[model samples]
Target: MQKYLPLFPLNLVVYPMEALNLHIFEPRYRTLINECLDNGTTFGIPAFINGKLPGFGTEVKVTALSKKYEDGRMDIKTEGIRVFRILDFQNPMALKPYAGGLLEMLPMPEVRPFVMVGLVERVKTLYRFIDEENTFDVNKPQPYSYQIAHKIGLTLEEEYQLLKMPTEAERQGYLIQNLERIINTLQEIERTKERISMNGHFKNLDPLNF
Candidate 1:
C-alpha cells in the first residue's frame, strides 16, 4: 500500500529496529518533529546519496523527546519501524516546510536460520579482530542482520544496498559476504604488520638442508 510519508533526507542509512538520536535545530525539521509528536505519526529518513534521494528509506517513529529547549530546538530519539520505497517526492509538501512523498511500504522477511547463524559468527569474528575482547551483541529476542549492520564496517552505500534486499535471507547473505571480506582484509593487514615488525628483529634462522 502506498501512503504519504514525511521525508527527512539524511546522509546515513538507518535499519529497522535501529535507534537514531537526532538533534532538531533546523526550523523545518523542528516543525516536522513537533507535528509528528502531536499527531503520533512517523517520518521517512531516505538516505541521501550523491546529493540525491535514493531508492529505499526506513520509516522512523519518534520514541521520545529527550530534551526540549526554550528556543524550540529539541533532541529526539527515534526507532526505525519499516522500509519504504519512494514513488515520488514533493519538494515542499503542500504548506509544510519539510518534504513528503508517496511511499510503498516494503515487507521484511524473517532471518533464515542458516544464513543468520553464519552472519552472527562472522560479525562476532569481525568484532574479535577489531577488539581483542569482543562483547558486541545484537538486541535479542530475535537477532537479525540490521542489528549488526551499523556495528560492522558497512559503508552507507552498502547499508542502503542491504536495505534494498527484500528478504532477511538476502540481507543475511549480503552481510555474511561483507563480513567475510572485511575479516579477511583485517587478517591480511595483521599479517602485514607482523611482517613489517619482523623486519627489524633478528630471527633464529635454521639453515635449509639442500
Candidate 2:
C-alpha cells in the first residue's frame, strides 16, 4: 500500500519487528515525537548513510512515551512494523519541522523455521564466538534474521542491505554467508593470539624423519 510516512533519518538500521528506544531532545525531533504521540501515529527511520538518506527504511509505531521532560524532551519506545521504499521526500512539510515522504510499504515474509540446519548451527557458533550463546535460544519465538542481525557484528551497511531483502529466505542466505565469513575471521584472530602468546616459550619438537 502507498501512503505518506514521517521520516526520521538516523545512522543506524531499523528492522521490522525490532524494538528501538530513542531519546528525543532536538527541537525538530521533539516536535515530531509530540505530533506522533498526539495523533497516535507512526514514523519511518531510514539508515542515514554516507551523509545521505537511503531510499529504504522501516516504518515504526510509537508503542509508549515513557517519559516527558519539562523541556519537552522525551524517551520513547518504538517497534518496527515493516519496510518502506521512499517514493517522494518532502522536507519541512508545510508547517511541520520534520520530514515526510510518500512511501510504499513492503510486505514482510511470514515467520518460518530456517530449513538450513547448517546455518542454524553456524549461528550457534557465531553466538559462541561473541559469548552470547545463551541468547540464541531456539525455543523462543523466532523473529528470524532480524533477531540476530545486530548480535553478529554486522556493519551498518550490511544491516541496511539485510533490511531491504523482501523475503526471509533471501535474508537468511545473506546472513549465512556473512556468519561464515565472520566465524572464519574470528578463528584466525584466535589463532594469531595463541601464536603470540606462545612466543619465547620452550617447545618440544619432534625430530624429522630422514
Candidate 3:
C-alpha cells in the first residue's frame, strides 16, 4: 500500500531492526521528533549519499529520548522497522521544516534456512579473523542479513544495495560474496605486514647475537 511519511534524509543507511542514536539540533528535526513522539508515528530516513536522496530507506520509530537538553536539543534512540521506496518526494512539505514523501512498503520474504546458515557461518568466520567479539545470534527463528552487515566491513553503497535486495536469500548471498572478498583482502594485508616486519632481518646478524 502507498502511504505518506515524514522524511529525514541522512548520510547513513539503517537496516531493519538496527538501532540508531541521533542528536536533534536543528529546529526542524527537533520539531519533527517531538511530533512523532507525541503522535506515536514513524519517520523515514532516506539514504542521502553524495547529496542525493536514494529512493529506498528505512522507517524508524523513536524508542527512547535518552537526553533532553535545556536548549531543546535531544538525544534520541530509534529502531528501524521496515524498508520503503519513495514514489515521490516533497521538499519542505507544506511549508513545514521537514520533508514528506509518498512511500511504498517493501516486505521481506521468509529467510531461506540453508542460505541463512551458510551466511551466518561466513559472518562468524569473518569476525574471528578480525578478532572482534562475535555477538551474532544464529539461532533466531528468522535470521536477518543486517545482523552482520555492519560488522562485515560493507561500504555504505554496498549496505544500500543489500537493503534494496527483495529477498533474504539474495541478501545472504550478497553478504557471503562480500565477506569472501573482504577476508581475502584482509589476509593479503596481514601477509604483507608479516613480510614488511622482517625487512631488515639477516641470518648472519642473528648468529652474532646468538
Index of the highest-TM-score prediction: 2
Q: List, residue by residue over 76-148, the lDDT tens digit for candidate 1.
A: 9999888899999998999899999999998743532334567768877887787755554544522377777
lDDT of every predicted structure (CA atoms):
0.85, 0.85, 0.85
Candidate 2: C-alpha lDDT: 0.85
Model 1 bad stretches (over 4 Å): 108-115, 132-143, 206-210
Residue range 14-91, candidate 2, lDDT tens digits: 888788999999999898888888999889998899998878999999999999999888899999988999999999
Clashes of 2: 0
For every candidate in turn, the CA RMSD to the true structure comes to: 2.3, 1.9, 4.1
Instruction: Point out the worst 10-residue segment of candidate 3 by lDDT.
Output: 108-117
Considering lDDT, where higher is better, how would the candidates rank from best to worst? Answer: 3, 2, 1
The Cα error of candidate 3 at residue 52, in Å, is 0.6
Q: In candidate 3, what are the lDDT values of residues 1-210, reduced to their tens digit?
A: 788999999998998778899999999999999999999999999999888987999999999999999999999999988899999999888868899999998884354244456776777778778898987675543446877777789999999998899877788888889988988998899899999998988745544554
